[model samples]
Target: MKKSIAVDMDGVIADTETHFLNWYEREYGVRIGVHEIQGREENEMFPDKTVARKFAFTPGFFRSLPVMTGAVEALKTLMKSYDVYIVSAAMEFPQSLPEKLEWLKEHFPFISWRNIIFCGDKSIIGTDYMIDDHIKNLDFFKGTTIMFHAFHNVNHNHHQRANNWDEVLKLLVK
Candidate 1:
């Protein structure tokens, strides 16, 4: 039996940090350096917290996000031995469902529709392993939790960590 792995979209397979930086600079004309946001959540990084929070609600925001470095190759490698599923909490922003689906189709054509899960909560996922940036999601997971490194989660230290997709391959693709 293949052990299933649940993977997050934003800040995990998607380069959400870079997305924020690019969009923030474009919208506000103030470029916030990566170092300035380290160990801080996205909302806290912007001058106006509401501006950062509104980014996800903006149309085309999810579809235009850049894929994380090495994510596609790493996931393809994992798929040989694991049942990998892209699990995202998309209900908060209802408009993101279609955008996220389109983004996945564009970048991860190999992933089947059955393997994509868009739900309000991740606690229902029963995979043997999960990789996510949010501590809130990983906290309730019964499986082995691997914290994917993100600027927002730099201060977290409770779970097993993978700083990059290379490290993820090292940790799980045996």
Candidate 2:
């Protein structure tokens, strides 16, 4: 039996939090914290869906985002042993998920779309292990949850915490 690992995209594989924060601050003129940015409650921040859609459709959002340190290398290592699948929240804008995945592939060519899951509900996807940065998602998963720490999630206390992708790889391999 082949083991399966589910990986998150926004903060886990790609360091998109910074880019999102910058864009939010520039467009909304509000100095939002990283926690609020990743909270997934856009209604609290943006008054309407139009603004949210604008943010999602913004060109270069994918290109400007940076890959998380050691994410590509660690994924490569994990792929050697387990079936690694990327489970990410779909962008509100049309075609955003496909476009972003393409951009991500340019950076990490090892990942394929067949192994990617673009959905809002991650718990529905079956996987043996999960590496994510969100506390809510971690709580929803009933497997080995490795919390990837970020400035926003510094206060969250989980049984497993990985400061970087290398640490995550080490934990999974063990």
Candidate 3:
């Protein structure tokens, strides 16, 4: 039996930070540097506290996100050695379920629909390993946790860290 790994969709495989930065600049005509966002929550990245929520709730928001660098290839490689599942907290955003599935189909066609999990709480997951950006999810996971590095999560040292797909490959692809 293969060891299963549950991977978060947002900050881990999807370039949500970049999406926010780009959209923020387009909407506000103000460019926010990544350096300015360290240790801040996603909603706190903008001067207007509600902007992030608006962006997330906007149509095409999740579907238009860029794929994280090297994620496609790294996941493909990892799939050969482990049972990889793409898991996302899509219940919070009513429109995210279908958008996320479509995005996955476009960007990661190799992943089966059966392995995709869209849920509100990740604690129910029973994988052998989990990669996530949120402390809330990882904190409750019973498996080995990998904190995927994002500007928001930079200060957290609660779990093993992976700064990029290269780092993730090094940690779990062996």
Candidate 4:
């Protein structure tokens, strides 16, 4: 039987931070560099918490994000031997599920609808491997956890780290 891999969508596959930074600059005229994002909290990245929260609540923020580079090709390679599932904690954003689905349909048409799971909590997912950018999801995961590097998880050191999809492929596809 093939090993099952559960993948997180946000900071892992979707470059949400870049989306937020770009929007923040265009909308608020504030420039936030990767180095300036020193913490995990979204509000910590900005001088105004309200602005950060406001941006998150915006209608299309989650729906419109660039896919992380190399993620598609890496996933395609992994799918050859792994039962890959796109798992996301999307219930937190009431408006994101549909948009996320649409985004997935556009970028990852090869991923079947049956392989996607959008939920509030991810601890219930049992798989052989999991790649996520958040510690909250990876901590309870019942498998080998691969930490996809993101600004929030820069200091996280408990699991194996993959700085990019090329590193992820080196660690998992072998």
Candidate 5:
């Protein structure tokens, strides 16, 4: 069987939390702590369609987001061994998905659209390994979940906490 790897876009491949927090604060007029969003339910973070729609329409949201450290390098390494696919959550507005995808392409030209998989439920994708920052998704994947460490997730202990992409590459490639 061909080996496959599913990568999460927002947190794993890109440092989107910073942009998300900034956008949330600017739009909602309230500073949302990363910790508050980390373990909570998704609905609690984005309560209604209004909030979701606002996020989707936010200008330069994708362009402003930062790429995670060692993400590209790690992905390059994984690409050698497995079919790497970006299995991310679909945006509330489908149009927003393409923008986010374009942002990813601009940042990492090495990644192609054919390898990208945007969907709400990633568990159905059937990858041998999953690299994500969300603990909930990691739990759902039930594979060799490599938890890419972030500020909010740092406190939450996990079996596979990759401090950098080098470590993640090592784990996945081995």
Candidate 6:
């Protein structure tokens, strides 16, 4: 039997930061660079979280995000041995559900719908491994946690880190 691995969509496979940064500049006229995304709190980048939070409500915000480099290829390689599941804490933004599903289908059609999980809490995930960017999720995961490197978590170093797909291959692909 293959070990099952849970993967987060945003930051890991989806380019969410770029979408937010572009919206921030167009919506608020603030030019925030990727260098400024080092904060642990995502909303801290903006003067007020509402500025960013408000944009989350925008339609299609999560639908068309660009895929991260090497993610598709890495997963294709990993799939040969592992049961890959797309697990996302997306219930917080109910509107994003369909969009996320669509985005995943467009980019990762190899993943089956049955393997996709969109829930409110991640503590219920029962898998052999989890690849996520949030410390909150990684801290509670009862498995081998692989922290997918994201701008917000650059300073964090507790869990095993996979800075990019190449690193993820070495860490998970054996």
**What local distance difference test score does each model get?**
0.94, 0.77, 0.94, 0.89, 0.74, 0.89
- Lowest summed lDDT over 10 consecutive residues: which window, candidate 6? 36-45
Candidate 1, residue 8: the lDDT equals 99
Residues 37-81 of candidate 3 have per-residue lDDT tens digits of: 999987799889999999999999999999999999999999999
Residue-level lDDT of model 1, residues 1-112, one tens digit each, is 9999999999999999999899999988988999998988767988788986699899999999999999999999999999999999889999999999999999999999
Candidate that beats the other on lDDT, 5 or 6, i.e. the better one: 6
Runs off by more than 4 Å, candidate 3: none
- What RMSD value applies to candidate 1? 0.7
Candidate 4 segments whose C-alpha is farther than 4 A from its true place: none
Worst 10 residues of 2 by lDDT: 37-46
Tens-digit lDDT track of model 2 for 65-108: 77888888898899989999988877444456767778678987
- Which candidate comes out best when scored by lDDT? 3
Q: Tell me the lDDT of candidate 1.
A: 0.94
Q: Tell me the spans in candidate 1 whose CA falls farther than 4 Å from its real position.
A: none
Task: For residues 1-174, write the lDDT of model 5, one tens digit per residue.
Answer: 558888888777777666767777786788877766765444455545366446646766655678887788778878888888888886544766867777877887888888887787666767888888778778777668888876557667865898778888778776
TM-score of each: 0.98, 0.78, 0.98, 0.95, 0.75, 0.95
Q: Which stretches of candidate 5 lie over 4 Å from their true place?
A: 21-57
Model 3 scores a TM of 0.98
lDDT at 32, model 2:
69
Candidate closer to the true structure by lDDT (higher is better), 3 or 6: 3
What TM-score quantifies how close candidate 2 is to the native fold?
Answer: 0.78
Q: What is the lDDT of residue 24 in candidate 5?
A: 77
Q: Would you give me the overall lDDT of model 5?
A: 0.74
Residue 35 in candidate 3, Cα distance off native in Å: 0.4
Q: Evaluate residue 89 in candidate 3 and report its C-alpha lDDT on the 0 to 100 scale.
A: 91
